[model samples]
Target chain A: MSRVAAFVFRRKGGKGWHWTDIVTWVWLVGGLFIMFGPAVWLVGSSLKTPAALAEFPPTILPYVTQKVSVEGFDKPFDLYEVTLDDGSKATLAEVRRIGIVSQMVDPKAPGEIIKVNIAQRTPVREMSFATENYTEPFTHFDFFRYLWNSVFVTVVATLITLVVNSMAAFALSKYEFRGRTAAMLVILATLMVPLSVIMVPLYSIVSALGLFNSLWGVILPTVATPTGVFILRQYMLTIPDELVDAARMDKASEWQIYWRIILPLTAPALAVLAIFSVVWRWNDFLWPLIVLSRKELYTLQVGLSIYSGELNVQWHFILAMTVVTMIPVVLVFIFLQRFITTGIAGTGLK
Target chain B: MTIDGSGKTGPRVGEIAMAPVRFAMGLVDAPLRKLQKVAGLGGMATFFLLPNMLIFGIFVLLPFFINFAYSMTGGSALFLSDRSFVGVDQYARLFDCSNYLDPNSCAEDTFWTAVGNTGWFVVLQVTLMIAFSLVTALILNRDLKARSFWRAMFFFPVLLSPVVVGLIWKWILQRQGLLNFGLYGFGFDPYAWLNDRTWSFAAAVAVSIWAHMGFYTLILLAGLQAIPKDLYEAAEMDGTRSMRVFMRITLPLLMPNLLVVIVLVLIRAVQIFDEVYVLTGGGPGTSTLFLTQYIYETGFATQLRNPGLAAAASILMGVVLVVLTLVQLGLGRSSDKNGGRK
Candidate 1:
C-alpha cells in the first residue's frame, strides 16, 4: 500500500482506528475513484491531440508538443518545401516511411515523388496544443444551435412546470372539494406510469397536434410532471391556511391568491422544482431524438449523439463536447446542491 | 371585516376617483361569486386544477388509454383510423413460442431475447447496486475526514446526463480505450469490452450501476442517519459487538429504505434504455437489447414500424412497473405503520 493508504489505516494510541474504520476508508476511497475518475479522464483526453490520443500505452495527460532534432529526416516534415522539376518550390504534402527510405509528395505535382535519405535528413519534433479539438466541432457543426435549443427548452419547460404544478398543488392542498382526494390519487397513480408505456401513443398525439419536428413537441409533453406536483403539493401543505383566509378577506381573487400569495411562499420548493426540471429537460434524449428530425432542432444530447456517429469516431472531439454539455448542469448542481440533496431525500422518504 | 380604530372607514379621494373602475370590477365579480355559490368550492377547485389536469390528461392519461387501444389494433399507420382492430393478436404474437425456455424458438425472438437479457440485467444490476450502495452509504455515514467531499464525489455522476455517462464509459471501455491500454501496460492482450456479446451486456449493467448507485446510496445514507444514535449507544453500553449491533440494529432499521431502493432499482433497471442504447445500441447480436429498446426499435427504427406490437410490449412493461410500484406503496404504508407503532 501507498503512504496515504497506510496513513488511512494507521491508529493513534488513544484514538485507535478499528479494522472496520480501515475497511470503510478503503471502500470509500475505492468507490470515489471508480465514480469520479472517468470524468476527470474525459476532460484530460479532450485536451490531447488525435495523434497523442492514439499513442500506445495511452496517456492520461494531454501531450505537450515539443520540437526535437532527430538524425534522419532532420527538418520538420510538414514545413519542408520540395524542389519541383519545373524549378518551382512546392509544399511537402505527404511523407511515407518505408524500410530505409522516405518518400515525399508535392501536391503541386501529384505524380512525382522525391526520395530522401532517412539517415541524412533532419527531423524535428513539433509540439503544440490541440485546442482545435474543442474549436473544430463548433465551427464545423451546429453546436451553438444545439446549446441554444437546450437552454430554451429547459427554461421554458421548467417555468411552465413550476406554474402549472404549483397551481394544481395549491388547489389540492388548500381546498377541500368533491373528488379532490380522487384527483390527487389519480395524479399520484400516474407517477407509476413510466414513460416507456405511454411513449408510442404520446408520439402519435404530438404528431396529431402538428408538433412534429418542432421543439414544442419536446417541451409540451413534459410540462406537467407528476413528481413536480407531488413535491410542490407536499411543500404547499405546510403553508398555514390562515394566510389564505386573510387574503380571502382582502377580497383577492383566486388567481391572485395563487399567483401572489402561494407562489411567493413556495419559492424554495419552486427552486428545487426548477433545478430538477432544468436537469430533466436539459438531459432529456429519447423524446427529443424522436420529435426532432431536423438537425437544427436537436438538443445538446441528441446533437452530441449525432456528432458521435460522424464519419470516424473522434474521441477527443466527443470528450470535448461532453464536457461542454455537462457544464450547465454541474454549475446548477454546485450552486443548489443543498436543495438537491435534501429534496431528493425528502421525496424518497415521502 | 372591521377596520382598525386608527384607520379611516370611508373611501379616500383616490378610491372615489376609481368608482367607475370599481363598478366594472363589481360587475365581473358578481357573476363569478354567483357561480362560486352555485358550484361550491369543488367547482372552484376544478377551475384551479384545470390547466394541469388538461395537460396531464392529454399527455399522460389519454396516451395511457390510447396505448392499450393501440395494442389491440394492427397496422403501421400513426393514425388510428388507418388501422384495423385485432383483439389480443399482438399479445398472442409476443407470447408465441415453441420452447418457452428458449427465446430463439419464439416468433418474436428478439422480444424474448430482450426479456431474457433484462431478467439477467435486473438480477445482477439490482444485487450489485444494493450491495455497493449500502456499503458506500454506511461508510459515508461515518465520521471520516473530508466526509462531505467524498459524499459529493460519489453523488456527482448521478447529476450527469445518462447519455454522457454512457459515452464516457464507452470511451473508457472500447477496444483501444483506457481499459485495454491498462491491460497492455500489464503485458496482457486488449480485451474487446463492448464488441463481445457477454462483455457488452455486463458492461451495460455495470454502467447502469455506476450511473445510479449514488442516488440509492443517498437514500440509504438518509435512512442510516434517521436511525437513532441512542440505539447504538445502548448497544455499546450492553457491550455489544459492532458486528452484532450492525446486524441487529442498523440492518433492521435500514430495511424500509432497502426495500424502497430494491423496488426503485428494479423498476429503473427494467426501464433501462438511454444508457445502454447510447453505449451498445443493443448490438453484438441483441445481447443487451432491453424491453424499452425493443419497444423503441419495433415502433420507430425498423421499416415496418409496427406500432401495435410495440404498444403491446410497452403495456407488458407497464404491467411489471405497476406491480413494482404497488409493492413500493405497500412497503411505504407498512413502514409508516411501523413508525406509528413506535
Candidate 2:
C-alpha cells in the first residue's frame, strides 16, 4: 500500500512527485499490467465454465448462474430476479422457458407457476470455479503420461548433464592435458549452435541409432551443453589448487580428488547449471517434437502444444494444463530468484 | 583417504547424509588409483573429457557437417545412403528467384517470405526490445520502494515457457478473447487482432518483446548500476541537462552491456519459433512465418517434405547465426581487453 502511495507522491525529497517520478510510476504500473495481468487472467479463465468462457464482453471473474433446489424439481432451477407486473422485482426459481415467457416459481411457495417475460428476468450468478476443467482431462487424455515424460526427461537429463558436463569441466579446469586448448575452443565455438539448426541431421543420427520415439533420444542428444561446461569450468577454476594438491599428497586417486573435493566445492555452480538444465529440458519442444512421434511419449511442453493446436473447443482445459505446466519453474523462481539472478550476474552467463 | 581437517563448521548434516556416497566412492578410489598409476594423469584427463566430447561430437559437431551433406542431396530420405548428392542444387533452388524482394516472384516463395519475415522481425524486435529494456532499466534503477518486488514482477514473464506465453496471449488476443471483450465493453468495435496480416505481424513482434524484454531489462539494469555514481554526480554538479548527461556518460559506458544485449536479442530473434509458432501458427496466410518455423514445417510437418531444401534453408540460417555469434564473441573479447583500461 505504501508502495502505491510512494508511486503516487514520492520524489526528490519534495512533498509531491516530479513529472519524471510520475512517468516512472506510469512505466512501473504499465509493466505490472503487461507482465503480470495475463498470468492472472489465465488462472481466472481456467476456472470459468465453458458457457462462461463464451460470454461477450466477458466477466472479470468466473461466474456461474446461481441455482436453487426447489421443493419439487428434478434438477436444480436457475434462480433469477423477475420484474413483476407491478414493477417490483423478486428472486424466483426459473422452471421453463417457452419463447418470450418463462415459468418461474417461488421456492417458499411451491406448485404455483408465475409467468414472466424472459427479457424481464436476469440470471443470478456467483463467482465459482469449474474444477471439472482440470479433472476432466486426466480421465480422458494422457495428461499424467505427458507430465511423467516431462519430469523423467528433466530429472534424468539434468543428472546426466551434471555428471557429464562436470567431468569435462573437471578435466579442463584441473589438468594441463594434451589438446586442452583445442577441446576448450571446440566446446566454446559451438556454444551458439542451437538444436534448431541441426535438427535435420541430428534426427537422422538419433533414428539411425534406433532411438526414435524414445525419451533417451531427447535426453542423450542435448546432455553435453557447451554453456553448462563453460559455466562449471569457470566456477571450478576458483577452487584453490591446494585442495587438489593435498588430496594427491594423501595418495588419493585423481577420480577421488574430483569426486570428493572439486565436486563438492563446485556445488553452487552445479546448482545453477542443474537449474538451467531442468528448465531447458522441461521447456524443450522442438527437438522432442522431432524425436517423439508417439503420443504417449510427449512431454508436457509437446503435449501442451499438441492440445493447443486442437484446443479451439478445449481452452478451459488447456488453460488449466498451462497453469499446471508453469508451476514447477515458477516455484523454483519464487524461492531461488535472488540466488539465480545473482548467480547469472556474477558469472555473466546467458 | 582424504581427511576432513580443513575447517569444520558444525555437525555438517549434509556431509553425514553423504557418508555412504563417499564410502562407495572410496571403493572405486582404489581401482581408479591403480588405473591412474598405469595410465598417468594426462590419460585420466582424457578419460574425463572423453564422454562429454563424444556426445558433443556426435550430436552437435558431426551433424553440423552432415547438415551440409543433407543440403547438397535432393531426396526425402533421412538416411544419407538413400540420398544422391546433386551438388548445391538445394542452394540453387533457394536462390531460384528472379527478384529477392517480391517473395511471390520466387520459386520457393514461402522460403523467401520466411527470410523477409525473419529479417524484419530481427530488426524490429531487437530495436524495440533494447529500447524498452533500456527504459525499464532506467526506471527500475531509481531507488524505488519495493524495488525487488518490481524487479521480480518485470521478470515474471521471462520464467514462463514459450508455449505458455503463446497460449496466454492467444486467449487474450483471439477474437472474442479478453482484448476484444474489453473493447466491446468500451463501446468500441472489437478488432480481429490476429486474423489480419499487419496486426498479426505487429502482434508477433509485440508478444516476443513482452515475453523476453524482462531478461534484457534485468541485464541492462545491472549495466546501469555498474556505471560509477561519481561520474553522474560530477555531471550533476556541472548542472548539465539530464538528457545530455545520459547521452554523454550513460550511453558510452553502457555500450558494452548494450552490445551484448543487442546480439543476444538478435540471435534469439532470428531463431524465433516456439512462441510465434504457437501464437500465430504461421497465420491466416503465412504472414507470421519466420525462418525457424519455415525450416521445421518444410522438414517435418509438410506433406511434401523437402528434406534437402529444408536442410539448405537451415544451413543458410546457420551462416547468419555464426556471424552473429562471432560478433558477440568479438565484442566480449574486446570488452575484456579494455576492462583494465576502463
Tell me how each candidate scores on DockQ against the true complex. Answer: 0.33, 0.50
| Predicted chain A of candidate 1: TM-score | 0.82
What tens-digit string does per-residue lDDT give for candidate 2 at A1-350? 99898776555676665677878989999888888899989998999998888787789889989989998678999999888999998999989899999999998897899999998999999989899989988988899999999999998898789889999999999999779999999999888688779888888999999999999999999899998999989878888888899999998789988888888776667767777788778888888888998999999999899988887788889999998999998897787566556655555665
CA displacement after TM-score superposition, residue A63 of candidate 2 (Å): 1.3
The positional error of residue A229 in candidate 2, measured at the CA in angstroms, is 0.8
lDDT tens digits by residue: candidate 2, B289-322? 9999989998988888988898999999999999
The ten-residue window of minimal lDDT in model 2 chain B covers B1-10
TM-score of chain A of each: 0.82, 0.92
Give the Cα lDDT of each candidate: 0.82, 0.87
lDDT of 1 at A195: 80
Lowest summed lDDT over 10 consecutive residues: which window, candidate 2 chain A? A341-350
Number of clashing residue pairs in every model?
12, 0
- Expressed as tens digits, the lDDT of each residue in B64-127 for candidate 1 is 9999999999989997778899999999999999997799899999999999999999999999
Q: Model 2: which residue pairs collide? A: none
The number of clashing residue pairs in model 2 is: 0
Best by TM-score: 2
